[model samples]
Target: MNLKATIFGLLVFFISGQFALAQSTEIEKEITELSKKKWQWMADKNADSLAVLFHDKAKFVHMGGTWGKDREVDIIRSGGIHYKNADVHEVMVEVLNENTVILWNRITLLAVVGSNEVTNPFMVTEVYVKEDGNWKLADLTFSKLMTRD
Candidate 1:
């Protein structure tokens, strides 16, 4: 009876570990897709779609300053800073848990600001939370890369 119980416990542990691994993989895939869509929306100046994706308390940090959701949305809407394109070099997503995910990406961004066009490499960090069965962007930070691309 002791042997049978120990074997059963080991089997359960192995199965649970596999389940967790599979869950994380799925979540990573979902977050990656969302991140791509976000870049597309920015390039297209689709503030309406972005508004839906960004959480009410979402924060955006840039080299110049940091702001909350409303300001970010307004900036995108008005084209104060246009995201013309993003040449993504690499992206990695980590599932913190069932409800949270973080993504980091390195990209060269083509942007226009105040009539000046610029291309810069940046490391972008994004945090997403699952709320009401949908993923919402909670935080976004951009760190300028010192290395010239």
Candidate 2:
């Protein structure tokens, strides 16, 4: 499909509530729940919980910069960028392989950065890998959106 058509399709998918009501597979439900909890963890600044969820070499990408797991944990712990809230409007889960999955969340985030409180729409991509029977976040990247509700 062309880029415009793809975007439109996604836009329609998000706007419709049918997907939310549809029954998900067992693994899909698991990952969706985990993703929801991740947002709560960030809002609560529970770095300890996040530390356990993030992979040892996980990478975090933000508007300002990109960093690894340690820095992300420290940033949350120190309130460098307080993730006050993430209003998740829609989400898509795509299982890549036996051990990998990709989750896309359309969210409007309320955060505090250097004493400045800001809210922005973002397309957040989270990649998860199953290791030792647990899912670890391998990557988290936030892409600011030009469109806003």
**What would the per-residue lDDT of candidate 2 be over residues 1-149, giving only the tens digit for each residue?**
89999999989988664554442355677888999999999999999999999999999999999999999999999999899999999999987765788999999999999899999999999999999999999999999999996
Q: Which candidate achieves the best TM-score against the true structure?
A: 1
Residue 123's C-alpha lDDT in candidate 2?
98
- lDDT: worst 10-residue window of model 2: 17-26
Residue 148 of candidate 1: its Cα lDDT? Answer: 57
Residue-level lDDT tens digits of model 1 in 45-136: 99999999999999999988999999999999999889999899999998989999999999999998768899999999999999999999
Which residue pairs clash within candidate 1? none
lDDT of 2 at 131: 100
Q: What's the TM-score of every candidate structure?
A: 0.97, 0.83
